[model samples]
Target chain A: MSTIIPFGPQHPVLPEPLHLKITLKDEIVTDAIPMLGYVHRGLETLVSIKDLDQMVQVVERVCGICSCIHAHTYCMCVEGILGIEIPKRAEFLRIIWSELHRMHSHLLWLGLLADAFGMESLFMHCWRIRERVMDVMEATAGNRVIISINKVGGVRRDLSPDQLRWIAQVLDELERELDAIKPVLTNDYTVKKRTVGVGVLTKEQAYELGAVGPTLRGSGVAQDVRMTGYGAYKFIDFEPVVEKDGDSYARTMVRFRELYQAIDIVRQLIRKLPDGELSVKVKAAKPEGEIVCRSEQPRGELLYYVKGNGSKFLERVRIRTPTFANVPPLLAMLPGIEMADVPVVALSIDPCISCTER
Target chain B: MGFFTKLLETSRVKSPWIVHFDCGSCNGCDIEILACLTPIYDVERFGILNIGNPKHADILIVSGTVNHRNAKVLRNVYDQMPEPRAVIAIGACGTSGGIFREAYNVVGGVDKVIPVDVYVPGCPAKPEAIIDGVVLALGKLKEQRTAKDTDSLAAELHQAREFYANRADRQVVE
Candidate 1:
């Protein structure tokens, strides 16, 4: 006679105000518990009334699908607290708009995990190829979806060789319409009977509940903060896409192999296209201390910190994000699942619950 | 049985579903309403769907800009959807409360709380105008299943507050 439901701070396949609580016994889940301060948006008290250029639009409004990795990690923590340089063609157009906002946020989390298992044609073929990478990030950053195109001392949009040969001919029509929906989403036998080996998450419970992205690369850690090279992911070159099982179809084959490793790092960032000046001016003044940057967002490792202190404003800012380190590995993969696989194992850890209640 | 209820009404007319709901802007129409459902505007060949409870939706989109702390969770997600539901709303900050129209923590649009039917404006409303506002909310869900007495969420919120108080008393008569 366990009982105790509570689902969310509001409930109905959730709309943020998280609250979990679970403990069923009848419907199965015997334990679950979560609760976060429903959108505690004081956002570290607007870093003392904004300044590092309006605190880069309050760290790209925390997370509209990782707002360009929180304005490119608050311009890499105010260019590592004002040392500023960044310009190898605005760090490869901020790694082609942060891997085209990580292949449109892992095809908008595989079309909300195919509209949460009800599949509706693989959720309209993964949001119709994430609208050709949100129309190549709204025709090269003029805002089609917060393409504020990260700025401070770099990136605010450039790519022209006729927009990198129309983004390599829309990456060969988005790799032939993402290879005609990868056999209805990775060999569809009803998406492998609703994500095979369901929600498991192990590699020592994803490194003791700190799983991030592809649910910590589907539990086998080949961790990926773009191999910590930050912007222009240290002159392109890829790999980190791992998968060791830890179930939910190996975190849906590690986000379908990081969407072919973000379409092969945007085809090697449009074949190493680098000319000059994407943006580099920064002189808005008022910045003094603390840094901490980090990137890899698209549901993982976002970090930010910031601090500064001279005048125009900011004196403290903090953001952790990647769903706040993937909520203690989504409450350790929600106690042996069941109650209708607890919202597809809490949407296989793609719970950006507006980037963990901002 | 009416041809197997006309093949379960042609597979629920290609599968409508949908549910969404942000109702407090600045997530940019919640990432163009999850990029109009993902592989780049694949409105599921018109069988559009995003369902996540709301009594198995048939569309109810609503993005954001309504405030006073999410207007009672946007009128409890339009009273937990179900009946011949439709809604839509979308952006230009869920239509009207754009740039947080003089924010004091906004409460502007989302049709002041519910009764929408299809707006899909912009400042974050593209994904092919959210697949032309979900194919004009599935053609106003075929004129709301042939209207047999409809308006009720408290008589459509007292006919949208007496049509916005007679358009604010017809702008106090020109």
Candidate 2:
């Protein structure tokens, strides 16, 4: 007999509300239906209320975890429409903050994953290492989570040489600490027991369901939006970390490896820092065209479609957060797993409901 | 307060077990709530345990605004908790709906549904502010058993108790 379990609008392991209707045959999941919109704030429609310039603050709040990138993408879209040329130095600065934000996001996800699997001590250690990156962000950007540095033309703040040196030192410290914890997460008997081969999405299955970020990379797709080189990726070397096994463990490994990639990208951007004016003056312009912007968020590809009239307020602002794209794959993966592993598998996608619902 | 009630209040104020509800919040407040549990913020130093179930929770830490769908669920979670419960609204959204205030779906703040004992207002309240808010909730917990919000729900719960008592008396007479 198959029993239906309403897993969550709230669960201990989950931070946001992503409800699941799981049909179980004995200990195994027979099917799962995901329900969203517990966090549908109707933020997109607010574009008309908030002007294009003020919308950066609104977009940053779309998902606090990936706040910097959301603001960056929105600004990039506006810049694209206005055809404003941002300085080279500003691009480097944007990459520095954005990649640092990526590290914070991944570390947070790793810690949450550990917590979900009941590895309380491991969770503590992951979050502890994560704080080092947050310290750098808070020191430079003035806020730990949401770094409001991006403007339509360029970034607001410029880093001093001394500050750059401090960031480098912090990066070294972060890498050293991260290396120590990698073994426990990768080779630990317990983490493996829970994550290895838990939620297997074949490479083809992943593509068809429109999985993004680590979820897509875990299934062996070498498709990272960074490769297209928006912001600073054109100047810096970039590559997507790929693992072909396509299971929960594979997904975890993809995120872990990307941490190193993000660190490397930061290093490259720092080395190639150019001397130029921070921003170009705007001519009191409003966006008069529609444009779509795509950038790599901590989760995956975040796309924004902005339609602006000659007025200060935009006609429409539509966001397709990575979690929204990745969620359908959960249904494909959940059917065969043990009922006990549902939360772990669900979390493996690193679902951000606020991003999706917004 | 009676001797036993005072003792209960003292103990409850000392070790507050919190059940965090997300409602319709962006992940900001929720992550900071988790950060409080981590080594840096270490909210556990104050003996605040982050629990899953409402029945065991002493403090309700809500991080989001109430939307149409989850409002009832939020109220249900609050009602299920034992007396001496404290609700700490942990972000600007939880307090006044923040940036999402004017959005069609938002119903303003967490206080719109249940009485918020302490409102820690940050776009996504900082970990330090969240810790302070929880500490402030301890003061409120000392004063009352559960929230004495002037709501129909509280009156209904009170009337149900009286209705059960009267029914028992009528049964005895019959």
Candidate 3:
């Protein structure tokens, strides 16, 4: 006889309001089902009410952690529909901010992961470092969480040369701080004991379950939406980090490695920074097509589908957030595991319920 | 009241154990709440702990707009907290439903279900503002220092008696 238990929609460990139904006999899991829509804000349905210009702000709030990339994806989609190339400088600026968002998000996830695993000191240290990343974003984009920089044709804000230097200096300091924390994170006994060999998703399983981003990368799959070359990715070059073990530790390692890669990408974009217009004047003529756009968010690939009918209002706006795509694999990975490790396993994919529901 | 009860009241004010509940928030306000516990804002300096269980918590700090799915859960969590408790609504979304007010499923502000003690206004309610709101809840906890159980019970008894008296008056008029 299996006893089914409900785990969330509100739990202490993960910030997202995801509900997981775990079926268990004694203490071992039999199966798990996730019930989402707890935090669904219905932004996609608002496309009819909110015009194309005002929709950028709505899209950014889909998930605050990946807000920049959400706006970047929307801008890219809108830009695609309009068939106008954004200035090279704007693309560089977009990716610079996107990379900063990635670093901050990774550090945030690391801190939360530490907190979840009962490593309180490590959690505090990670958040302390994350503050510096938020500081850089706050100084440049005017807000720490949302950033609100991306627009349809270009971007809302531009960083000065002094701001660029400041960001590099701050990120370098963050890299050094990460250097200090890496050894303990990777080799710590408590972390490894809880994470190693836990929730293994093989490469084939990942693909079958539709896993994306670091979840797919952790399973030895080298597929990242960033490789598709959207935004400034067409200019900067970096390899998607991957680990073959496909367990919780491997996923953590993948994010940990990608944090450094994010810094490197920002540095490259800064070096290759171009001089051009901040934005192109957009025509009032409504776009008349359907377009699908994808960007690699901190969690994974965020896909946006926008349909237009030559009006200021869009026909439909749909978002396929990374966490939504990764939920299937989360279900596949939960069977026959110990009940104590449920939260850790659930968090491995970094479930963003609001993004998922929206 | 005995010395132990007084001591318990004092301790409750000294260290308010706050439980955070996210109804349908955008993760903005929820993260800001977590950020306050970090080294940057570090509300722990005031002896406040972010507890996991509601029964042990003296304050319920809720963020985000309430949708139909989470209204009962919010009330259930609010009910679990030991009284002489307070609720702080963080973010504009929680306070007034913000941008999600017109969403089909959302039930608007949290006040629609439970009484909110404090409302911290902002899109996400910055960590500084959230810290201020929590600190303010601490102040309320101290203000209601004497009413641990008996006073609230007495108030409820009075309301019940008043209901009967009003019914009797109505009968007389009929």
Over the stretch A1-358, how does candidate 2's per-residue lDDT look in tens digits?
9999999987888888889999999999999988777888898888878887789999998999989899999989889988887999998898899999899999999998998889999899989999999899888888877778988888899999999989889889989998999899878998999999999999999999999989999999988998888887898867689999999999999999889988888888888899898888876777889999899988999999988898888888899999999989988999989988999999999999999999
Ranking 1 against 2 by DockQ, winner: 2
Candidates in order, TM-scores: namely: 0.31, 0.94, 0.94
Answer with 2 or 3, whichever has the higher DockQ: 2
lDDT of 1 by residue, A1-358 (tens): 8888987655555545566888888778868878654443445575665556666765675566667778878887888787888778888777777887888778877777776777767766777777777778778776766777777888766877888888878878887888888777677788788788877888987877777767888888888887878777777788888788878778877887787788888888788877877776877666788888777777777777878777767777777787778877777777767878787778788777656655
Lowest lDDT sum, 10 consecutive residues, model 2 chain B, at B145-154
Q: Report the Cα lDDT for residue A10, model 1.
A: 52
The full ranking of all candidates by lDDT, starting with the best, is 2, 3, 1
Clashes of each: 22, 1, 0
The candidate scoring highest on DockQ is 2
Sliding window of 10 residues with minimal summed lDDT for model 1 chain B: B145-154
Give the per-residue lDDT digits (tens) of candidate 3, residues A85-193: 9899999999998888899889888888888888999999999999999888778877878888988889888889999899889979988999999999778899999
Task: Flag regions of model 3 displaced more than 4 Å.
Answer: B1-5, B145-174
Sequence-dependent TM-score of model 3: 0.94
Runs of candidate 2 exceeding 4 Å displacement: B1-6, B145-174
Regions of candidate 1 where Cα sits further than 4 Å from its true position: A3-20, A28-33, A37-69, A72-99, A102-104, A111-149, A153-163, A192-277, A280-282, A285-310, A315-337, A343-345, B1-174
